[model samples]
Target chain A: MRTVTRLYLSNDTSARAAGAGVLADAWSEHPEVQLIRISSRGAFYLEPMVERDSPAGRVAWFNVTAQDLPLILSGTDGTPVRSIPFLAQQTRVTFANFGETEPLALDEYQARGGLSGLETALRIGPDAIIEELQVSQLRGRGGAAFPVWNKWKVAQQARADQKYVVANADEGDAGTYCDRMILEGDPFRLLEGMLICARAIGAGRGYVYCRQEYPGAAKTLRAAIQKADEAELLELDGEPFPIEVVEGAGSYVCGEETALLESLEGKRGVVRARPPYPAQSGLYGSPTIVSNVLTFATIPNILSRGGAWHAALGTERSRGTMALQLGGRVKHPGLVEVPFGLSLHQILEQFGGGMAPGSRFKAVQVGGPLGSLFPASQMDIPVCYDVFAKAGAVLGHGGIVVYDHETDMVDLARHFMAFTADESCGKCTPCRIGSVRGREILERIQAGSGTIEDLALLHDLGDTMKVASLCALGGRAPYPVLTAIEHFPAEFRAKLRT
Target chain B: MREQVKSVLARVRSKPPNILKALLALQERLGHVPTEAVSEIASALGVTTAQVAGVLSYYPDVRLTAPGRHLIRVCMGESCYANGCGRLLRELQDRLRVDVGETAAGGKFTLDTMSCAGNCAVSPTVMIDRDLYGRLLPSQLDTLLERYK
Candidate 1:
């Protein structure tokens, strides 16, 4: 008998809720249309999304709105699921089931190669899973694109009995929301991903340090953790892996894994010195696999489909899909799963649907609070980390922020400086003190009080934080300010005595 | 007097108020803690407001108000904002006659902004309680608000 595929009706829960119902209703009662209670995960775009068994793979491609539900139902998607222009363009490694499955459901996950990775990992052994992840080219989707396999291998190699796996869900970048979206869409995937990390890394416990602001994501994660416990998917030496949901009090620095671990242990969320990285000594002096939600989400997908499948999607070094929290002036501002090599223009125009309202796209603040701003002229730059760096920025968290012409680059620069200044943990002199000084320079520039000397001083302050700060939050804090000055030199130079 | 806070806090008798538990307790008691709670919390907890506010604003999840019984969290994050959350918010304000971050006179309706609802393609959507309303308008809110009334 078709299990009715349990559809959760929504507009009550989220777009995902209504989307799932609408998607379920679209399917002919082919012995597989089970409807479940609507979940409260709040991803309204992909409401009523289909389950794991849903052959409606197109759901993974776009955030299907309730209004689009009718078109989605009647819309016969004849294209091969992979070739669907929407999914085809995105690098789906991390967000494989974003639009495809019920986020909160455990059974739905298993139906579509969901837990197959865990099963495979358990069967083939953890070392082999590590090897495959290494070859598959899975890298961290958090701000830093560190290789996942290396982190795991390091954790596995680290001598410890109480190792841990933690998902860095404390995403608080102003123009970003990818981690939140993924959690809202398919939370179990994240839990399962963390579970897999726990298994391979020989972890006894795991934690998800979600930001305090993301109540929905936190709730989704909490429910998913409960679901994981119910299903007994968490394992330790073949036992249930002890993955706990730790709600961060909302420190922007907590997104930095170490700072997250500190907050998780009930301390202030502040940056830490690496080398004794979490891969070595983390989370209460235990070797830990500290990952971003996107990174964790990618694991199950990589495991189910095989690492090579993900590894094949991106450029040689930057493989798999990059989940983009498209923001700013773009028309379709949402999560975009694009191949790593796609140009920003393609992502912005084709995926994002172009500038919003009375606006000529101007500059973008990439990454989060710490990432830099890029001029529209650099829209040609590829989204790959290396390329973005060449263009004077690193694509942090893939937070593509668009500024229409009206947005003052100077103001934006000052705004970014102020944000970082406020968020600076004050742990390091450069970041703690330098960030404040940087804010002053921007203030000086904005007040028409600066000269080239002040501009030089601003650059100097930016450099000091970049090199001297302990964590990426401080290191990259100057990115937006520097990029703003580079692109809109006119704004600062006009105020400068050049 | 603060039953919700008492209930949640009672469970943490022996353990000191960790930031998570404290914030949860605060949110529980006040329905929504104001920005003032951050400062005033020290008096409540025998700590400083800066200490309280630091914890209050750090976590992305804790909000400051009780959304009227019918809470409509409109995604005003960049994606949604660009997708027309501005106009949508304006329309919501027009329909509700109350600006965002505020509850209605009758406590039947509350409108506020969110970072993102994860429903990017459905920009200009509203999440009332847990339910999400896509491509919303001032006119479309009546059905949702009626459920609460």
Candidate 2:
């Protein structure tokens, strides 16, 4: 049998998807390698990748096309594509291996050290895993600053018959892509992360419930799961543990932990009362460890590198890496993972490439809509969780959306209020209806309505939602509404009576 | 078929009332729900076709017809709203002649309004078939839509 070769030449979105078919046809003469494929996220820059299964070892390298496929398949070794400057510098902690290897091809994955963390776990026990994680000081990357160690510790200690590890890929938060980027770019890393979590907390099952908005992510995950199953990774038919992907039905509240569990149970998404927590009683009434995709995705890196190696990445109390989803009025917008405590200006200017050249920076909205809007001068503020807290902004989801000069902060407030209103799951009264009421006031303010009393009304509405809402989705739904009014008072005042 | 479905659903220990999980499992396997799934899912969950159909209808993302080959979901969320998203919405309507939630006639293009892409500064953005188009404008949209055509 001839050792055929398949090459993934690109990470350009459509090209990567389309090239798989091209490779299948290219290898028609020699089908022993089964399939040689290419994938690009349509980035256009990284094209012409090659994957060959030679006797020496499996060869999966980038920058080769079907035109070059014949030569490469004829056993011509290609130059490493990473040596190219433009393609080489992408710091892809999330998308590290995506498009470079076969998504479902387990042998390729295994050869490339895909599930080594799981293999390492197979050698060790859960408590050691927790110890390694705590030493890493890896904080939750899904917005909140809750220590990952504590959450896992709670799940580990919770008295329950069964524990679950659920990945909240339901990233309906207005400005977060750490989940989607990881799931689409590096599917196995996330799978390995979940498997590790299951192993850590004595969980027998895990689910990666992706939000309805991310079709590409959902498709990629489905493909990844079948591959994992075919490789005998997931426990099936009396096997020990099974990992699965649960597609969400397009609800923002489902991104909330409790609502996610309800939707998982086939009920209308509504938040459960807390304290018992999912650690106490979660999906299907089992003790569950519900973690955001970022939190879960961090596991493989933490385990492979050890905790101190990770703790070295960020500021004190905000240790480890952070994947910042840079958005809004910025020039270069995408995912950038750096150590925590990077200043806002450093992110906006250096990382974001500074607000579309001509645009003047007004306010940068951090963490999603529920997060605060920082005035531009405060761009010097460090982006650690505590620093953001002192400034009334939060590190929620590490999403940085910039607003330019022409953009009115009042209009921004209205838009955030509108999103919160539409996305509220109707479980809690404040977020359910209060978001609408708040949105109406925002509308009145934007449409040039009401007296100064509207500001007070906005404040009151925000306070009520904060005090009474079941989950963070509603509790902080009013942050954008209140913060915009407090910081950009003139915008709201402009709408009020003379 | 019910027996086959029950056997399959039993693989996950799904209860009789967990119709959503069952339908989702069907969607998971079939990519999208098939009309045939109504009968199979109902039978599997010990419910009726109407019950299954009713539940499918509740989910905004579930498709009765095959989804478009290329889905362009423009983020109409607040961050997008503040940026040139208003113009992008208008541009999409002008090009596709359909509002958010409506699919295009050709089935190649479906323009739906997603709440957020989480890439807000890159607002006025449309994820064409999940390939994100950041910092989109009327001109940029013209450049992008022409590719599909």
Say which candidate scores most in TM-score. 2
Off by over 4 Å in 1: A1-94, A447-453, A493-498, B1-10, B13-19, B30-149
lDDT of 2 by residue, B49-109 (tens): 7877766866666666665667788777655765678777888888888877677887777
lDDT of 1: 0.68
Candidate 2 segments exceeding 4 Å error: A1-113, A235-238, B1-13, B22-58, B62-72, B94-111, B118-123, B127-136, B139-149
DockQ of 1: 0.27
lDDT of 1 by residue, A1-498 (tens): 422334334322344433544544555343533444433222223333432224644322244433543343344332344554444566555565554556776787778677887777777778998998988887788878888889899999999878888888877765666777767667777877887787787888788887755567778778887877877776656566777776765456777787887777655677777888899999888898888888888887778788778777878678887777666566555567778888888887887668866788877666765676666677777778777766667777877767787666676677667667767777788888887888888788788777788878888888888887888767887877787778788867777644
Best by DockQ: 2
lDDT of 2 by residue, A1-498 (tens): 555344444332323332433554665565544453433322221233455545554444443455665566566655444443323444555455555665556677667767777776756778888898889988777766677878888888877777898999988767666676667656778888888888777888888888866777788888888877877788523456777777787777788788888887776677788877787789888889888988877788778777888888778888876777776667666567677877888877676767676788778778877887788657789879888877666888877777788887777778778877877777678888998998898788778767788888888888898888888887887877677777777777877866
